[model samples]
Target: MVGIVKYNMAKISGKVVSVLAKRGPGSGGTYPGHIFTKIGGQESISKLASDLKIGSVLITGTNGKTTTTTLLIKLMSNDIQIRKSYENNILNSIATALLTQKGDMGIFEYGIRNLTYGIPDTVQKLIDPIGVVYTTISQEHTQVAGIKNPFEDYYKAKKLLSEGMQRGAIVTNADDPRTALIGLNKASDVNINYYGIEVDNVEDIGGEDIECPKCGQPLSYSKHFLNHRGVYTCQCGFKRPEPDVKLVNAEFNTDSWKLTIEGDLFNYTTSQNVKFNVVLSVPPFGFHNIYNTLASITAYATFTPKVENIESTVKEIFNNLDMSFIPPGRFEVVDIGGKYVGLGQGDNGDAIKINAMFMNQFVDGPLEFIYTTPDENEEEIFNDHFEVVKSMNPAHVIVVPGRKSIEKAKEYYEIIKKEYPDAEFYPLSYDEMGVRIEKLTELARDSDYDYVIMTGCGEEQAMWEEIKKKMINR
Candidate 1:
C-alpha cells in the first residue's frame, strides 16, 4: 500500500517535470522518465505502463524500427488514441511518453545492441507489452561499448525481448530467418503474425551469405529480396514461415510505388480474427521501407480494436503518404543544381547496400563515391562496406573517418587504394566533427562528377544529417 502511494507521488513529480522541461530535444523525451525512475525506482515503471488500458507494443530490430514504429503509430492512431515515442530507443523515452501522453495504447521503438546495454527481459516484464514487433535483424554493431559482442549473444538479446511474453502477439518479418525463428519458437506461447514480400519483381541481385539461425550450416536462398532477408531453407529443416501479412504485388516507378498488401491476423485487443487487402500508393521510399510497410500494417491489424476500419485507415494513411514519413538521417536522393547526390547514414553493411541500391536508380553516369570509414575493432563492418564500394564501381573514391579512430580509417583506406589506386584519403579527426561534416559536404557539392553518393559509417544526425542539410540549404 505504501509502495502504491510512493508510485503515485513519483508519477505526479514526473508529470510536473514533463510539463516544465522546456520541451526541447532530449530533455522532454527522457528527463521525466529519468526523474521518475530516480525517485520511485525501476519497479514503478510497470505501474506507469499499466495506465494504458490496452497495454503497450514495442518495435525493435537492427534497422527499420523507427520507420515501422512511425507508420504503426499512424495506422493505429486513426482507429484509437495511442501514446507513442521513437528515435530515442531507451526506456526513459517510453516512460516520459507514459507520463505526458494520454492514450489507451502505448507504442514505443526499442533498440537492443547487446544484452549488457539493453535489458530486454526486464523491459518485457515491466512493460508487459501486448505486442512485440520485430523488424529484420542482421549484423551491424560487432562491438558495443568496447566489448566484443558476438552474433550469437546479439541474437539472444533480441529473442529475450519476447521470450517471456505469455499473452499478446509477436509481429515479425517472415523473410528474415532470424526474426522468423523467433516467431516460430514463440508460437506456442503467443500469437505470431509474420509479414514478408511475395512478389518476384523486387529482388536483390547480389548479397552476402547468411547462416541459418537454427543450424550452423549455411542457409540456401531461393530468392533474395534484401540483404540477408529472402526465401530460404536450411538442412535442419527450418524454412521461411508463410506470411500472415505480405506484399503480394508491387509496381515500382520513379516517383512512387504501388503496393498490394494482404493481412489476416489475430487482433489482441478485440480477441478476434481480422483481415484486409489494400493497394497503397506511397512515395518511392526504397525497398527496405516495403518491409517497414508490411511490419507496421501487420502490427496494426494485430492490435487495433476497430477491425472494420483496417482497409480504410491503411489506404487513408499510405495513399497520401509522403517522403516526410521517413526518419531523419536515412538515405535520400537530392538534386543540387543539376547534380544528383544521394546522401545519408549507412552505418551497417546491410544499410549501406540498401543505400547503394536506392542511389543506383538515380545514377546516370560518372558517379563519385564519398565513403566514410568505421572505427577500430570494426574490421568486419569495414569489409562489408568495402564490398559495397567495389560493387558501386565509382569513378573516384574518397575515404574519411566516420568515427573517432582516424588510424583505423587510414588502415581501411590503404586496402581500398590497392583496388582503386587513385582513391584519396582524408584523416578527419572525430573531435572536430564540424570540420569533418564541412569537408564531406564540400566534397559532394564541389565534385566534378554529376552523380555522387556519400554514405558509409557515420553518426546519423550529427554527421550525415548535418551534411545533408548544409548541401540542401547551400
Candidate 2:
C-alpha cells in the first residue's frame, strides 16, 4: 500500500496536473484528483496534510465560499504559509494538499454536498481544520442530492464543519437565520464569532424565507441583504444575533463606499479580544459580495489579533482589498468598441436577482441587457425580478441560449417580450463561446447605450473568458 501510494503521488502530481490542464477544455482540473484518490486513498492524503505547520481552514456554505476563501488568503497571506483551493471538492482538495510543497495553512472551500457524499470524512481525517466558516445557508442542488427539503439537508451539510471542529474558532453569518440558528445551537465550549451588516430597510425580495424553524412562525426582518438573509425575528422571541464584527453607517461614494466597523476582534488562537472603531473605504461590486467581504474580514480577525497600531492594520487590510478581488464572471466589466459591458455570472436564480438589483440601483445609463436564462425548472426565477429588471429600463434585450437547451432560452425571451413590449428582442442562435461573445460585442458596438449588461449562468458561464479575451484584443 505504501509503495502504491508513493507511485500514485508521483504520477498524479501538480506538474502532471498542469500538463493535463493544458491539454483541452474537457480536461477538468478535478480529473487528476480523481486519479490520485483512486490510487493513493485516504492514507496518502493524511500523510500530505500532516506536513502543514498551521493546519487548514475549511469554509463551507451554499454561496460565497469561493469568494470568501479568496479574501481570507489575501488578508492572512503575509503571516501564515496559507494556500487556497479554487476547487471545493474534497478529492481536488486532497490532491492540492499532496501537490503543494510549502502550504502550512490550507484555505479550502468545501462544497455543501461534502457531508452528504461522505467526502468530509477524508477531509477531517486529513487536516482537522484550525478554523471553519459557514458563509450562508440556501437551497441548492436539491435534485442532485435526491432530497426534498434543501434547507434542512443543506443545513445539516454546512453544520458538519462546526460539529467536527473539536477546538477551533467557527465564524457564522449572523444576518443569515439558518447559520445564526446553527451558531446558537453549538456547544458552549466552542469558540463562535458572528459577522453581519446593518442596513435601514429590510425587504423580502428574493423570497427564500420560510417559517422560522424554531418557532414555526413568520419571519420578520429589520434589514434584508439577500434571499433568506437579513436581520430576522420570529414571534416566539427568536431574533438575529448581534454580530461580533459589524459594518454600520455605509455611505456610498462615486466608485466606493465608506463604512464604519464597531466590534471586538477575537484572536482564534489566544482567545483574546480587542475593541476597535475603524472606518473602511470599499470598492464597488454586487451587494452579495459585501456580505462575503464582511464574512472574510471576521474570519481573518479570528486568527489575527490587532497590533499596537490598530488603525494602520485596518487601513492596510482594506486598502489591499476592493472590487478587483472579486472572481471572474461576477460583475466583471469589459471595454469593447468604446462601450463598457458588464457581465454578471451566476449558476442560480437568487444570484441572478441580486445581480439585477445591483445593476438597477447602482448603475446608470441607457442600458442594453443580454440575458442568458436559467433551465426549465428555474425559468420563472428571472421573472420574479422582472419588475426590478424593467425598472432598470433597458433599451434593448438580447436572448442567448441557456444550459438546458435552446428552447429554454427562447422560452425566457418570449416571457421577457410580454413584460417589456417596447424593448427589442433579438433571438440569437447558440454557437461556440467565442461566437456568442462576438455577436454580443457587435450588437453592443452598434447600439446606442452606456452599459451593455450580459447576465448568464450554467453553460453560458463559458462565455466569460471568451468575452474577456475578445474585449482585451479589441
lDDT winner among the candidates?
Answer: 1
What CA root-mean-square deviation does each model show from the true structure?
1.2, 4.1
Q: Using alpha carbons, what is the TM-score of model 1?
A: 0.98
Worst 10 residues of 2 by lDDT: 22-31
Structural similarity to truth (TM-score) of each candidate: 0.98, 0.83
Per-residue lDDT of 1-474 in model 1, one digit per residue for the tens? 229878988989998988887664422589899899888999899988988999999999999999999999999989888898899889998898888888999999999999999999999999999999999888886889888889889999999999999999999999999999999999999999999999989989895569998887999999999998999999999999999999999999988889999888888889998878999999998899999999999999999999999999999999989888878888899999999999999888999999999999899899999999888999999999999999999999999888888889999999999999999999988899888888888999999999999998888888887988899897
Write candidate 2's Cα lDDT for 1-474 as tens digits.
Answer: 347547556446644765565322212345555556566664666655556666667788877877887787677765556656754445565455445435567677777563456455456556677778888776554444333434466566677656766777788888888888877877475678898887654254644665786767889865667877877889988888889988776776658877777768667655678666778887766577777878877887787533344445556777656566666556566556557776656556556666676665545667887776655555344554354456557887776664545676777777788866655554455555556667765665566776877775544346665565565576
lDDT of each: 0.91, 0.66
Clashes (backbone N, CA, C under 3 Å), per candidate, total 0, 2
For model 1, what is the error of residue 144's alpha carbon versus the real structure, in angstroms, after optimal superposition?
1.3
Q: Which stretches of candidate 2 lie over 4 Å from their true place?
A: 1-36, 87-90, 113-126, 141-151, 187-189, 199-210, 305-313, 333-340, 380-388, 391-395, 422-431, 459-461
Model 2 — TM-score against the truth?
A: 0.83
